[model samples]
Target: MRRESPHAGPLRALFRQFSAFAGVGLVAAVAHYGALIGLVEGAGASPVPATLAGYVLGGVVSYALNRRYAFDSDRPHREATWRFATVAGVGFVLTGLFMGLFNGRLGLPYLPAQVLTTGVVLLWSFSANRFWTFRP
Candidate 1:
């Protein structure tokens, strides 16, 4: 029988965790977009503010789903909630900056700019949640 490499186990586990995280992200993204569209198209809200609200909704969904499904975190709610919120607060700042840059400065449509912002925030959220917030 062949022996497995030590790194292989860790890398595979990381991949699995990331995959689960992405799955949860999809659900959160829906909540984000729904709020975005509803506020922007329905209520005539500005793109930046609309996205800010949507981001909050998405963050709520992300926290709940990611804790139970993606990271399967056992960190007590008191600790985990703060850590998750910290990570999300940073993500929120990033989201606003990117939105301002892409949609406001560059004049990209709101949806497209948001897509780009989401990509950048996704990497940060996954890393922080996996290593800091959810780490056992």
Candidate 2:
């Protein structure tokens, strides 16, 4: 049998990484929406409050997963944590803005607002994660 060099599969490598990211993102998205719905529907919280709670919970999960799995980061330091938190904070603001736009201003349904926020949040997160949190 002919052995193929591991480095010979660029397409496979990209797909593998994309798959890993997507998997992790799916988990985080569930966490985000779950908390949001739980707070708003179950706990009778307002949309903004629910969204805030969701962001906090989802942010924690996202940081943990992105650090350990997505980026395979093992760095331990206040600096790294703060940097990561800063990036997440930026994401939070953007998420909140869109959520508010959809839910409050546009009067869209909760789920629809959440879906819209998800796309924006995902793009923002990928940028921050790639450029800041896990930058080389």
> Model 2, 79-126: lDDT tens per residue?
568887888788788888988899999999988998888788787777
Give the alpha-carbon lDDT of every model.
Answer: 0.94, 0.79
What TM-score does candidate 2 reach? Answer: 0.83
Clashes of 2: 0
Deviation (Å) of 46 in candidate 2: 1.3
The alpha-carbon lDDT assigned to residue 114 of candidate 1 equals 96
Reference-based TM-score of each model: 0.94, 0.83
Q: lDDT score, residue 2, model 1?
A: 100
Q: How far out, in Å, is residue 92 in model 1?
A: 0.6
